[model samples]
Structure formats: structure tokens, C-alpha cells
Target: MSVSIDISGLSHERIHVVPSPLAELGMALHALSEPGHHPGLQGWATAVSTRLDPCLADRLCEADFLWRSTFSDVFAPFAGLPGQSTLPGATLAEELDQLDKLTDEQFVDAALEFTCQSTYSEPDRNLLADPAVQRRALDLAAARGPQQVKFTQRLLDEPPVVRAWLRKLLEDCDEAFFADTWARLSHQLAADARLKTDLLRRKGLAEALKALSGAVSLDESEQLITVDKITTGRTTTGSGGLVLVPTSLGWPHVMVLHRKGWQACITYPISAPGLTAPPTVEQLTRRMAALAHPVRMRLCRHLARGSYTTSELADAHGMTAPEISRHLSVLKKADLITTRRRGRYVQHQLDISVVSRLGSDFIEGVLR
Candidate 1:
């Protein structure tokens, strides 16, 4: 279903575009755990598998349908944006303890909502006579039955322990791969945040918001928004504010979620050239090689002064237009410069973030 939201009077300035190491790590774990479903992620699967705890995979639930429900237990979309996520400061145990605060009814209600319930009607004969309580148990079982029966039964038997088990699984799986993956993906995340921040400064919130997705558009005439992959009246699509999150894990995917008391959000995937698989330090090698050419280096300097037309750069540097064109193409490939055609004239401007490494951590030892 399409989501139609009226943002005319809402505060667009409340938008936040940021990255989350934890959420991305969650996606990574999910991807690697179910590699058969994602051929494109085989490279990441290979890299992550080398360090994973074999036993953790068993607990992670191989059934795609079941796993997503289980995943939400640990990484639910709360009302607030990730900036307010408990994951930042809480250890896995502490996070599990937060789950402890959830009443059994609340947990069951959430788990049941995630899956199909058409087939089942009541809990097992032993647990409770209350038809409502019986349905909760049976619904959990039925939801996971097609893909896996045992995992759901585990949830029923040890309702309170489900979160604890998830905590350990996340710990095991994340410990194996998160640091390196984060190191590789953080550059893209930071660059995204910086880019959006700059866009907001230069273009205002409307343009910046629209730039987020091909399927999403803002209709200023009616102050309405039609966003893709989101149904109307869900979470916080058009309530009053939004949070924009960028992640490498989300590169091929976009997710929208809303919860009361939390920032309604949409997360989109982002990509970095030559660094799609991970270890984006290779991007450093690519960028450095791009700057190695004297003409390209000169082009970067001239553009840094301000955006320029190819012919203008050619005359300033005493080069042929064709030669300047070739240099610009190379710099563009390196992401050091960006170009947009203004009428018949192409304008080239420096992408300063790359010059500053997008304010990400330096490759400590990769480039000598």
C-alpha cells in the first residue's frame, strides 16, 4: 500500500540523517545468517563466516520467516530514533534486562503480530484455559511452524528467556563480525550524514527529503508526501517529523517504521565505489591512485576554488578541452569531484568530503 502524508505544517527541520552501527550490524548478521537467500552478499558471508561462532548460527534460526520475528525481539523499532537507542550504552545483558521489563502479554502480543495467524485459533491444551491466552501461544507456534517448529516452541516454553537467548546470539554473531564491518561501512554512513546535512543547509528540507528515495516525493501544492514501500497511517510517516538513517546494510533496501514516543524513520541503503564488499580501506587506495596524476591533482585544486566549466578550466590550465574533459572524468570516477550540466555547459565542483575522508576514521595501517 502507498503512504500519503501531509507534511505542510510539520517541522521538516526535525529531520535527522545519521548512521547506526548497531542497526547495520543487525542487518549484517541477518544477511550472513541467511546467505542462501542473498547471492549478492556471498562476499560478506564468506568474510563473516570465518569468525562466527558455529553454535550461534543454530540459535539464530535459519528459517527466514521465523528469523525476522526473532530479530525484532532484539532490534525492535521503537518510537524514538536510534539516537535514543539503548544499544549505545547498554551491553547485551543490559539490553536483555530491558526486555525483562516487558510484560508477558506485551511480548506475546508483539510476537503474534509479526506472523500469520489464519491457521490457528488457540494455545495448547495445558497452558491456560483463557481463550485469549491460548491464542497467543498457538499464534506464536503457527507463525513459525511452516519454517521451524522448534524455535517457536522454545519461545513458548521459556518466554522470558527468549530475549536472553537472542542477546547471546547477537553477542556471538556480532562479536565475530561487527568491528570490521563497521570499520568498512562507517565511511559511507558518515558521508551520507554529512552530505544530507550539507544538502539541508544549501537546499532546505524539502529538496533534501526528496533526494532520499526515487519512490518518495513531496507534493508542495498540497503539502503531501507519497512515499514508497510504506502504508498510510503507520508509525510516524507523516505525523509531524521524521528521521533519515543511512546504512550500507540498507544499500539495497529501505525500511520505514513508526512507534509511539519514538522518531518515525526511514532507512535507506548507501554504496561506496570499489568498497561494496567491506574493508573500505581499499577505497583509500583507489582515491590515492586517482590523485596520483598531476593533471587530476591540478583539476582538483582549480575546482576547489569554485565550480568551473571544462572550457574555463582548459583555458586557465592551458590544456585542450578534450584533455580537461578526460581529467574531469577521472576525478569524477575517484569521487573527488562531482559534475552537473548547467544547460549546455557542464559544471564541475569538488566533493570536499572525500578530501577530508568524509570525516571518518583514517585507515590506520592499510595505506603506507
Candidate 2:
């Protein structure tokens, strides 16, 4: 549920605040591939999709395995590809240049390792050298999905071909849309990094880590910085220490890469300018209307206590399951609630933050 970064005996100098173009590009690609998750960029994503060349789109489709997965270290310079050294590059060209230095064996190894992360629990890079191991890895990849299996096969059988294809795809993406997008966002990204650096200097690591994102927390007593994540792991910040990369497009998702032989890196979403603008009148109206009903208001009060399944809510409220589900749907549409699966039940809970912000959002909407 959390990633604990041990910072015992680590100097402040080891913790860096750097802006990465490749990491931003990786996030952009992810935003492009899964537009629904990034509601803020829906307009931009739609425009980019319309302008994309058919051939380039096909190539992007082929490489969905890389961007679709949350573990996109292949595009990050700090978490360099397997057998490759880490480099904090300022520009995309510099990052790609670092990637270009990878040998055929290293490229294949990196792809294999990335695939293994999505499929197997324990990934042994040493075994990747064995042809039998590669075959088994391919089988595991097959179980994940078609895109993963195809990419893995190409990576293993045609390393050079895949390497060239990947390079070209990145280049084409830059030319198509990412170049302009980065140009517009780079200033904000750099400013965020500078702000983080200043915070680290003035407030110390505890405050600085806490300011990274809502999902991050610091425990001074334990000397650990814990990140709220689905998969849990712990890594000690050794001599390499920690690198914090600020990304604009990586909103709502904080990714931490702490693999062996690399400095632990956390790529977090920056408080993007203009991106987190106040809600519109329509949004405020919808949210207000969602809680205006007597039944829904009572439901919100109950959900504020804890999460409940539709059946549980129905039982508690003395209502049918269908009636509870309809009200829950209205709240969900208004972004007043969130849901998660717990075994066979789908538990729904009030989005307290959204509810709490309604008053300010309504005032801002009316005034604006």
C-alpha cells in the first residue's frame, strides 16, 4: 500500500529536484494512450489524435506496452534502461542520446526486464541471458495481453529492429506534437523544480517530501518517506540517495522507481499552473444538485463515516439495491464519491476533499 524510502544517514545533497523532458514525454504518451484517465488534457489529446499521421499512430499502437504500464522507466533517464547508467538530462535530445548509447544486448535486456515487471513477481536479469529464460518470459508476457506479447517477442528476436523502431517512434512523436507541448510546459516544469529545491533548502526533507504530493508522507521518527501506492515496497536510500523528478503530465499518479544499481527516484506531479483551475459553473451546479436531494444528502452523511457496498447501503437505508445504486450513480457522475473493489464487493465512499471544496468552488464560479 506504500513505498517506504529510508533516508537514514543520507545527506540532503543526495536528494535532487530535477525536471526531466523524457519523463514528461513518457507521461504525455501515457496521457495520449489513455485519455479518459487524464480529464484535464482531454482537449489537447483529442486535437493531437486528430493530427497524428496514420503510420505514426500505427507505430504508437505497436509500442503501447511501454506507455500503458505505470512502470515507464524505459523513458526515464534517471532510471536508465537495464545495463545502462543513469543520467539526469535537461533536454529530450540529451536523454535520447543517453538511450542511444545502449548496446543491442542492453536494449533487449531492458525490454525483458520491463516486461517481467508487468508479468512476473521476481525478475532476474541474470537469467535473461539464457535463451530458455527468454522463452519462458515470452510465455508470461503472452498471458498479460497481445500488445505485451508482441512487443516482448520483437524485443527478444529482433533487438536491433525494435531498437531502431523505438528510436524512430520517439523522434516522430516529438516532431508530431510533443515538441510543441514540451515547449509550452517546460517553463512551468522548471519553475516547479526550482520551487521544490527552495523548499528542500528551507524546510528540510520532511516538509519537502510532504509537499511533493497529497499521496506522499514523511515519518521523521522512522526516517522513512512513505508514498501511497497500490504495490508496496521499501528501499533504503544508500549512497546514491534519492532523485525527485517533477513532471506536469504525470498528474494524479506518483511513480517511484527504486531498482537495484540505480538511485531511488520518485516522479511526482507538480502543481501545474492553469491546469488546476477552479471548476466551471456547470460543474459546481452538478455537484450541488447531486447533494441537494434528501436521500442523496443522507447517503453522503453515511458514506462520510466509511465505505459501503450498494447492498450494505440499501440495507442500512431501508431501500432497494436498485434505488441505492441509482443515487450512487448520480453522486459518482458529480464526482462526489469514489469506488474501489474489495473482494466480491464494490465499496463506495464519499470524496471528502471534493465535498469540502464545494463551498469555495461555488463562490469562485459565481464570482468569475
Candidate 3:
């Protein structure tokens, strides 16, 4: 599944690289919620976890429905909230001020849109008014957890309260740690934006898009930029064009927002120096050991060509399914491979980028 962006009429001027404090804050909250998922930011997340005020932490836990959503639209820039700015640069203060200005109706709509559980259905503005749809949504949220159930209920029954609670939660987050976190990340984020802008200027759109991340690719013939994502959809740049926002906390996840009434934007991860720690000796040794086996080396070579199921790999290697599974597990543990579900089967593919970086990583580890 992938998001194919139609960029046929997109001009160089339409491509933007901006830093968003709002997006960063949302990602940071997500990282906080799932610290184990973001190993790169674990140290920083742990430190922040320690500093969080107990009340503020509890408030964030209540809003798990926001960050846990596939697309956290509430934090998305230009989400059509009243008084929200669509410009390239806006400080965290400015963004929060805009959030503060959201009417009860606007806030409820945005929250509902984010919390919508349907895969094929569009979010209804009058969803709360429809008893049947509201009950279905509530039931889905209830299955997830009590927090989501309470959040959905608040969004349905108490729009004003939900709006105020969200605003205060964000304000409290800034006061607790996001203020300092953004300060530390702002300079690096600005530098990454400038570098991307330069890449766009010199190499043009195709190369710039290709350089964005391994997950992004440009098909010149199709006039499309495809983002490897779990959700599949196609959207045009329209007259609003596309905005590329660089975020540090949003590592390992690239979010594409192409919702109606909002400018299309892609929030991608940017490397922030001195923030993420380098691989420790144990990590490097693990990677080396995973590749040391002759069978695993052959497996990597085969996976480089295309994704294969465990049985397919076993057949190719003249090995049993259990044997192939053990080798795959080692590679997976070392982050040398990735897996995706395809119907009833699971396909494993090589993480070529990580493998490509091994030599440099080894040299850096040695020098350090």
C-alpha cells in the first residue's frame, strides 16, 4: 500500500520545506506513548518521561486517541481550524494561539475526524448528531480502551470541554518539556529545511523527493511521488500545492496529510545531530553477528531482489521452514530486514539502507 501524489503540475515554488513545532510536539507525544517503538529517541523520551508532571502525564494518557490515530489530524498544519495559519513558518506560540481560537464546533470536528475508525468511510461533520454512527464510533473506541471511550464521549457530548481540555493539555506540555525540547530541535530543523531547499533548487524535484527518505520515490513517467505507507490513496496537489515539513521526533514514520479543506503536506523525519545516540558496541556486534552466518548472508542477497515469504525462502535455500525462520529472526533482531503482511502470508524484505550503512557505521564505531 502506498500514497501516490500527483505532482505533474507542481512547480518548484510549490514545494516547501518548513519546520513545524506543532507536528514535532505531536510526534513527541507519540514517542512518549510508545517509547519502546522509537529506540532512537528512547534516551530523550526516558528523560522527558521523568520530568513530566503527573497531572500532565495523565492528561496526555487520556488523549491517547489523538496520537494513537493513524493520522493525528488535530496537530496537522492548515487543518482548516478557524484562524489557523497556512504559511511556511509559524512559531509554537503562534500555532498554540491558533488552537486556542478554535470554536467548539471546529475543535469537535477536528477531533472527530482524527478519531474516526472507518477505513473506507469519510468522516461526517454531523457524526455526533447521528445516533447510530455515534454509537458505532463509541463502541469501537470502547474496544480500544477506556481512555478512548471517554475521549469519544467527551468529543460527542461536551465539545466545549474537550476543546478547552485539549488546549490546556497542549499548554501544559509546553510548560512541562516541549518548550525546551523545541528550542533544542529548532536550529537543527531549520538547518535541515535549508539543506532540503538547496537540494530542491540544485537537483530539482525528482532528486529532492528521492532524497527525502527511503520510503519516498518519484516516478517521472507517472508524474507521481509515491510514499510507501500502510494506507493507500491518491491525491493531487491541487491549487494549494504541497508542503514538506521536517520533524525530528517523527522518526520511522512519515505522515502524509491530504485531507479535504487542508493543504497537502508530508511530515518527514530529519536527522538531528547530538540528539540520537550512536550505536553502542552491543548493537554493532549484534548486526555483525547476524550477518556472519553463511545462510543469513545468502538470505540477505535473495531478499535484496524482492520480498519473499518464509516458505518461499526455505524452498530457495533448500532448508526447512523452521530453519529459515530462525535465520530470519536473527536478521530481524539486527534490523537488517523488515516484514509486511500480505493477505495470509508475511513477506520479509531486506532493509538495504541499513545494510548499506554498515561499513561507515563500523568505521565510526571504531573511531569513537
RMSD vs true structure, all candidates: 18.0, 8.5, 8.4
Model 3 lDDT tens row, 230-284: 4567777766567888988877678787655556778888763232334666788
C-alpha lDDT of candidate 1 relative to the true structure: 0.56
Candidate 1 per-residue lDDT over residues 13-121, each given as its tens digit: 6566767655676667656654432445777778767756666655555533433422343344332333433322123334445555555544544444334331112
What are the lDDT figures for the candidates, one per model?
0.56, 0.74, 0.73
Q: Over 4 Å off in model 3, which ranges?
A: 69-71, 81-85, 100-106, 109-125, 272-368
Pairs with backbone N, CA or C atoms under 3 Å apart (clashes), candidate 1: 79-262, 79-263, 80-262, 80-263, 123-134, 235-258, 250-269, 251-269
Worst 10 residues of 2 by lDDT: 114-123
Better of 2 and 3 by lDDT: 2
lDDT of 1 at 91: 37
Mind giving the per-residue lDDT tens digits that candidate 2 earns over 49-140?
A: 99999999988877765765454556664554443235469888888886776666545655654342432234455433677777777765
Error of 3 at 2 (Å): 0.4
**Candidate 3's C-alpha lDDT?**
0.73
Q: Give the Cα-based TM-score of candidate 3 against the true structure.
A: 0.71
